[model samples]
Target: MSFTSDQAVEALRAAGEPTRLRVLTLLAGDELSVMELSRILDQSQPRVSRHLKLMADAGLIERFPDGARVFYRLSSDLAARRLVDMVLDLLEDGAADQDHVRLEEVRREREAEAAAYFEQVAPRWDQMRSLYVCESAVEAAIERAAGPGPFDRVVDLGTGSGRMLTLLGKKARLCIGLDLSQNMLNIARSNTAKAGLDKVELRHGDIFATRLPGQSADLVIVHQVLHYLIDPAAAVREAARLVAPGGRLLIVDFAPHALEQLREEHQHRRLGFSDAEIAGWLREAGLATSAPIALPPDTEDLTVTIWTATRAETAKRSVA
Candidate 1:
């Protein structure tokens, strides 16, 4: 990917500054809100916002809002990412030691908060699963849909409890499980180790921006995670971006229910999703989806649906 001459100069001008360069360096690993940026940089929120605005306007970074908070990350465009990466590569190591140290502390605090919540909920997850539906039935359906394969690389987004990793571990050469909660990651680590999945790797990461290589995963699984996201379609697009050409993405979630209780109690941003809605999202992400397989409970519990979408072998490479 190549940028226009003018765009190259513009991106450079945006990143050429001292503060903006530090911002790019910090964002390379994870997305940060303006408040977090301000805390790490020890700059006023207004000043940090100003730096973010310049980088965003120059296309060196992307800005998004979640509720009342606005967040920024390195640009998702291929050419823009390439330029930012090249510029950051020129900076000497430890160029801003203080900034790096503060950044680590801010991230740790965020993880600790998330860890506390997960720790409180992790024990009840199995009980919740049983209340919603039969856990064994869901696992069997996922395993059958995933197919027995000697996959090169398998990625499990929102890998909570590492159950999926244990199920798919023996079928893959490598297994990577990502979760936002450090406590959940610890659980997954223990569970996978007990299962003897020596090749499994766990990361505290965002599903929307994994930073993993594009088109490298033979299989990508997003099991029962979309309901918690503010934008389920965006999650699907990000998951699809990781699938290798001709590879498949498997999503397991609810099939549209009137479970109003789940919304308030479970932190569900969306109650459930319809098959057509999910298929549309997959299609928009440049994947062809087949009919979804639904497993309903005997009572009025939530019904779990599994949707598998495939990318054509001739599909274009992901931008990032």
Candidate 2:
């Protein structure tokens, strides 16, 4: 048999059991000692050890000696990690019952606190560029769709840091940014001005119900914003509605996952969308769409997915 087949059989056999899968999810984000795993799963140390040993042998987790004790974590194998992430994504949000709800609440509180801290220090946003990786692949996708041009109008939804607009400044004759927070908008305005791009305008708006003109923009870019919305499908529909004939809509966000803890803590609207979900949203919005191109591995914890949609030629006449 081929190595691929052999590996597949082994992986399936190893992950087929519920206990091992649980072990993987527990160790997805951080490491845990055997005792910690036992506590989290409410299982005996011997049972947890048995599961961990199987996963480690299957190359799903690694061991580290800490004095006389050992810690276990999700393995370094990218493929194995990807498998664990996919499986976890399939699990339901309430899988952990009340514990899940409480954890999500705590996560939301922490994220709000962090967002508030960023808001208070909004003036220092420009200096915080080093803290994040500039999503180059998304930038490349937007440039490909919109091209270098003196676009008459442009809309950047969820324009965090106003980075997408700044990236489009070379071509957008008039760029408008819509976001929820006054503080984020303030930072966006300052950043645009500092870049000497006076044609850009910032507004406090929700992507779901913004009053912006429909079918006006030559390019609509929503980068790193959909995952945070409560109704990503609605947000995508709104984004598509903003695209004029011959216009392009660009979306960048995570692929779907079962990580309820991250969703609850981070205020993520959804774990993320898979390629199928992205295609469905674009088609429903009356735009011809493309599959997502995966972002580079080094981007961030969130995977980057790009979908480029162009208004159908007949779409011009179908408008109300």
- Give per-residue CA lDDT, model 2, range 1-320, as digits (tens): 12266675676678778777766765664455686567667789999888888878877678855334566877656777777777789888756454334434544554466466546656665455323345555567667766667788889987767877788875888999998767889878887887889898898887877788778888898877776553467788899988888888888776654556654454543566778768977997889986567765453455567788888655654333
- Flag clash pairs in model 2: 89-257, 89-258, 107-265
Off by over 4 Å in 2: 1-134, 257-261, 299-301, 317-320
Which consecutive 10 residues in model 1 have the weakest lDDT in total? Answer: 109-118
lDDT of 1 by residue, 163-230 (tens): 89999899999999998877788888998999999999999998878888888898999998987764
How many clashing pairs per prediction, in order? 0, 3
- Candidate 1 clash figure, as a count: 0
The most accurate candidate by lDDT is 1
